[model samples]
Every structure is written in C-alpha cells, then in structure tokens.
Target: MTAALLAGVLAGYGIAIPVGAVGTYLVSLTARTTLRTGVCAALGVATADGLYALAATLGGPALAAALRPVLGPLRWVCVLVLLALAAWGAAGAVRRYRHHRLATHAGAAPVSPARAYLALLGITLLNPTTVIYFAALVLGSQTGDAAGSGERVVFVAAAFAASASWQVLLAGGGALLGRMLTGHRGRLVTALVASGVMTALALRMAVAPV
Candidate 1:
C-alpha cells in the first residue's frame, strides 16, 4: 500500500507538473475570474485526472493498446479545440477591455463557478495524454498483479489528492497575478499573452510525434 501510494504520487506529479496548454489556460482563466471560480476549475481538472487513473488501473495494458490507435485523431481534435479556445479568449478579452474602458455595464456576465468547473473538466477530458500517462504508469509499474483492491484505492486516491493540491496552487498563483494586474490594460495584456502561449503550445502538441 505504501509503495502504491508513493508511485501514485509520483505519477500524479509527473503528469500535472508539465504545465502544458491546459495548465496555461487554467492560470489565465483564474486571472480573468475570481479565485472561487478558479478553484472549481482546478477541481474539474483533478477530477479528470482521477478518472483517467481509475480507468488505467481497471483496464491495464489492454486499455493502453486500445487507446493507442485513436491517439492521432484525438490529438488533432484536441489541437483544434485548443485553438478555438485561444481565439475566443483573445477576442473576449479585447471586447471586455473595451467595454470596461467605456464604463459600459452591459457586457456579457462573468462565467459562473459551475460553468467554469464544467468547462475545465471537458477541456481536460479531451486531452488524450492524461489517459495515456496513467496507462503507461500502470503498465510500467507492474502493479496490476500485486496490488490488491485496497492498494488500488489508495493509489487512485493519492493521485487525485496530489493533482488537486497542485492545481489549487496554480489557481492561487493566478489569483495573485489577477491581483497584481488589476488595471484594465494590464489584464488585457496578460490575457493576450496567455492566449498566444496557449496557441503556441497547442500547435506544438499537434505537431509532436505520437
């Protein structure tokens, strides 16, 4: 159990610490919204991670083989979705900045915490890497045969906790960023930069060898 827990922690951090397109978006989303919404989004990401981990534990090597064939197409879809999100974020930030500058209160309402949670969850779920990472960890560890039911539970729980903690820390950093850049122009600039970073990362993911 202890070894399984440790392995799970390492696996969770291995996947979550990469700070790819999804991580970039999470920080930017938090910067544009409240910490409460950011926390919800963070949980959403952690939830997806946990779900993938669970699937890996249950399905083992067979799951990995099944998913390998679909990875190429799935990655393309992920790239397109990320590109769309980047464009939307950039345009929305500009529109919001203009409205704020003009002191017009008729702009679109802020995203609610629930919606933020669901949106992040969906975005994270679309990333095939999460499942592949989990599957790889499971197969590489050779834990399927040795780990009993309780050990598997502990592993999954530890992974979820580790991921949640890291994601929340990211949200906290984003909140700090939002506080630092409270000005309209500062927020707009930050949003644009983040959007650019996200787009670049998405393109990299698309072109990366599977």
Candidate 2:
C-alpha cells in the first residue's frame, strides 16, 4: 500500500508539474477572474486527473490497450477543444481591453462555482494525455503483475491528492498575478500571451506522432 501510495504521488506530480497549455490557461483565467472561481476551476482539473488515475488503476492493462486504439482521434479532439478555448479567451481579452473595463467585465456575471467547476472538469477531461500518463505510471508500478483492489484505491487517492495540491498552487499563483496586474493593459497582455501559448501547444499536440 505504501509503495502504491508513493508511486501514485510521484506519478501525479510528474504529470502535473509541467506548466503546459492548460496550466497557462488556468493561471491566466485566474488572473483575470476572482480567486474563488480559480479555485473551483483548479479543483475541476484535479478531479479529472484523479478520475483518470482511478480508471487506470482499476482497469490496468486492459484500459491502456483500449485507449491506444483511439488515442490518435482523442488527441486531435483534445487539440481542437483547447484551441477553441484559447480563441474564446483571447477574444474575451480583446473585447475587455477595447472597452477599457476589463476588470469589471471579467467579474460582471457572477459565475456559479458549480458551473465553473463543471466547465473546467469538462475541459480537462478532453485532455487525453492525462490518461496516457496515468497508464504509463500504472504499468511501471505494477511490477508485471496486477494490483489488488485495496492497493488500487490507495493509489488513486494518492494521485488525486497530489494533483489537487499542485493545481491549487497554480490557482493561487494566478490569483496573485491577477492582484498584481489588475490594469486593463496588463490583463490584456497576459490573456493574449496565455492564449498564444495554449494555441501553440495545441498545434504541437495535433501534429505530434500518434
């Protein structure tokens, strides 16, 4: 159980530590919106990761094999989803900047925390890499053997906790950045840069060999 727990923690951090397109978007989104919203979104992301980890643990090799067949299609879908999201964010930033009321506009519609959570969760779920990552770790840690249900549960919980901590930290940093750069131009620049980065990442993912 301890070995499974440690392995899960390491696996979670290994995947979450990278500040990829989604990470950039999370930070920028938080910077633009309120911290509460950011926290909800962060949890959404973590929840997705945790769910994937659980799937990997429970399904083992069979799950990994099933995913391999559809991975290429899934990757393309993920890329498209992320690109769409980036465009939306960029457009919102542009509109806010042009109006010169970026802050007010950002917080205009009091977004429900539940909705925010669901949105982020849905977006994160579109990321096929998370499942692949979890699968690789499960394969490595299984020691050429299957794990018992108890061990799998511990593994999943550890993975979830690890991912949650990292995501929360990202949201916190974004909230700090937002507090620092509350000006219209600052928000505009940050949002645009983040969108660009996410677009680039999506392109890379799309073109990557399946």
Best by lDDT: 1
| TM-score (C-alpha, index-matched) for candidate 2 | 0.92
Superposed Cα deviation of residue 113, candidate 2 (Å): 2.2
Candidate 1 overall Cα lDDT vs. reference? 0.83
Model 2 has an lDDT value of 0.81
Residue pairs clashing in model 1 are: none
lDDT of 1 by residue, 1-210 (tens): 898899778767878888988888889988888899899999999988888877777777887888888888888888998999899888887887987752211266677889889998998888968856876876787656567888889888888889999999999999899889988898889889988998998899988998
Which segments of candidate 1 are over 4 A away from where they belong? 101-106
Q: What does candidate 2's lDDT look like per residue over 1-210, in tens digits?
A: 898889779877877889897788788878887788888988898899888888877776777788888878888888988899789888888888888885534436755667778987887787777857866765665722477877788877887888889988999999999999988899888888988999999999988887
TM-score of each: 0.94, 0.92
Alpha-carbon local distance difference test for all models: 0.83, 0.81
Q: Which pairs, if any, clash in model 2?
A: none
